[model samples]
Target chain A: EDQVTQSPEALRLQEGESSSLNCSYTVSGLRGLFWYRQDPGKGPEFLFTLYSAGEEKEKERLKATLTKKESFLHITAPKPEDSATYLCAVQVGGGKLIFGQGTELSVKP
Target chain B: DTAVSQTPKYLVTQMGNDKSIKCEQNLGHDTMYWYKQDSKKFLKIMFSYNNKELIINETVPNRFSPKSPDKAHLNLHINSLELGDSAVYFCASSQQRQKGEKLFFGSGTQLSVL
Candidate 1:
């Protein structure tokens, strides 16, 4: 069965703290991996898309790196406003995205 | 202007009642989708339409139906709503049905079944 799992279900960090969220997957015919940021009571916002191993993308304080079996979303000196649930999804055949349970991060100022 | 939008930000109802959630996207995208987020905040895809044609339909209940009246509009209707149906339903769109395309989502509709 194809599956995606994210580690650290919940995280509390002080402002300027750094951390990394993990998303491990086991699936067949992997097409892409995606990252999204979702706030409370709102829909998810697009962040980045990784197509293959060793691919990396960065925006602001967030950087996403992908490997053969897992992906990491590294937060460098996060701020309060940067606190949100980060979601990871893997695209398989037919463009279907299998999502993992998101990691909720709370950054206190 | 909002790129993608859904109606009824919140819907509270009793079990067995039927309701509909409407969605529209102005991004000129060729594809639209419906995703459900449960209490654990795990998102799962329900249905997807490309240019008003159903392309992907997951193993969802038959009581749930998705209608795409046009290329830009997709609506979800639930019949005989159950208590387990309470969740946030999100409407999303993308440029195409090809791989590696990022989706643009709307402010989800929170559904509560009492």
Candidate 2:
């Protein structure tokens, strides 16, 4: 069975703090790995998609890096507005995406 | 414009009542999906439709049916809603079956069954 596990279920950070959220998965075959940001009462917003190991993508203060067995989302100098639940999902050999429970991030100003 | 949208942001109904949540995507994508997020924050895929064809159906009960009238619209209909059915449902869309394209999601619909 395909499974995704995210570390540090929740994190509280001071404004301007940099942190990293971990997402490790075991899939039959990884087509792609995805990262999304979801706020309370809202749907997840697409962030990045990494296809191969050693690939990295960045947007604003967020960076996603992928490896053979896991992926990491790094937030640099995050602001209060960046506080939200960060979700990591992986597309198995099939076209369906299996998601992690997510890491709740709170940025205190 | 909203890339993906689900109608009735909140739905509250009694058990045994039937209800429907509608979803549409204006992104011109051919693939659409429905996901359920439990109160504990576990998100799971319930169904997916690609170009109006049923693609992935995850062990969802037959009482819960998904209707895709067109490629742009995929609506979920629940018959005899139960307390266990209460959860936030999200609608998402992606382009072709190709890899590397991210899925765009709607605002979501929160369902409460009492």
Candidate 3:
């Protein structure tokens, strides 16, 4: 069975605080790993896609790194506007995506 | 412009009723998908259509059916809705059915089955 797990279901950080969210997966064959940010009452917004181990991508204040069995989303100097639920998904051999339960992040000002 | 759009941003109804959620994409993508987000905030892929053809269907109940009239549109119809069916449904599209393509998503439709 293919499964994705995200650690630290919820996190609270003061403005400018930096931290990393973890996404670990178990699948037969890894095809891709995706990161998304979802605001309250809205769908997820695409962030980054990592295809192989040691791959990393960055956008603004967010950086995503992927490994053989897990991925990490690191937030740097986060602002209150950056508060959102971060989701991680893994694509297996098939084209479908298996998503992990998101991490709710709160950047208090 | 909104890349992907879904109708009925919020729907609340009784169990046993039937309803449908419509989704359309203006991104000129050939592949579209439907995903359900439970209360636990876990998103699960329910169906995938490529060029109006069903490409992937997960373990969703038969009551949940997806219709894609064209590559730009995909709708989800639910029959005999149950309380467990309450969740947010998201519509998304990608340029193609590639393994690592980025998906553009619409604001989800929140369904409440009482």
Candidate 4:
């Protein structure tokens, strides 16, 4: 079974704190890895898309990197508005997306 | 302008009631999808339709049915709603299956079953 697991289910970080969230996956065939930020009561907002191993993408204070079996979402000097659940998902065959449980991040000022 | 949108931002109903949540995309995309996020915040794809063709159905219960009237519209109808069905439902769309474009998601609809 293709599985995606996100570690540190929840984290509390002070403003300006930098940390990384881990997502490990095992799939039959990996096509793409995606990162999304979701606020309370809202759907996920697309962040970055990594296609192959050693691929990396960045947006503001967020950077996403993918490896052969894992992906990392690195947050740098996160602001309070950046407090949201970060979701990691992968695409297998036929565009089927398998998502991880998500890492809830809280940034306090 | 919203690229993707879902109707009824919040729904509260009793068990056994049937309800329909509608979704529409204005991105000129050819594929639409429905995803369910449970209380634990696990997002899972329930159905995917491409140009009105059923492409992916993830072993969801028969009570959960997705209908795509066209390339831009996809509706999910749940029969005999149960408490466990209460969750945040999201509607998303992409450019195409072969391209595997990134999805544009709606704000979401919260369903509460009593």
Which is the leading candidate under DockQ?
Answer: 1
Each prediction's interface RMSD?
0.8, 1.2, 1.0, 1.3
After superposition of all CA atoms, the RMSD between model 1 and the true structure is: 0.7
Question: By summed lDDT, which 10 consecutive residues of candidate 2 chain B come out lowest?
Answer: B96-105
Best by lDDT: 1
DockQ scores for all predicted structures: 0.89, 0.78, 0.82, 0.71
| Reference-based lDDT, residue A107, model 3 | 97
> For candidate 3, lDDT tens digit of each residue in A3-81?
9999899999999999999999999878789999999988899899999999999999999999898999999999999
TM, every model: 0.99, 0.97, 0.97, 0.97
* Residue-level lDDT tens digits of model 1 in B1-114: 999999999999999999999999999999999999999999999999998999999999999999999999999999999999999999999998688998999999999999
Model 3 lDDT, residue A79, Cα: 97
Displacement of the residue A90 alpha carbon in candidate 4, Å: 0.4
What TM-score does the first chain of candidate 2 have?
Answer: 0.97
Candidate 1 Cα outliers beyond 4 Å, as residue runs? none
Docking category of candidate 4: medium
Give one digit per residue, the lDDT tens place, for model 4 in B8-44: 9999999999999999999999889999999899999
What is the full ranking by DockQ, best candidate first? 1, 3, 2, 4
Point out the higher-scoring one by lDDT: 2 or 3: 3
> Which 10 residues in a row give candidate 1 chain B its minimum summed lDDT?
B94-103
Candidate 2 residue A33 C-alpha distance from true site, Å: 0.6
Q: Which portions of model 2 show Cα errors greater than 4 Å?
A: none
Model 3 / residue B26 / CA error / Å: 0.6
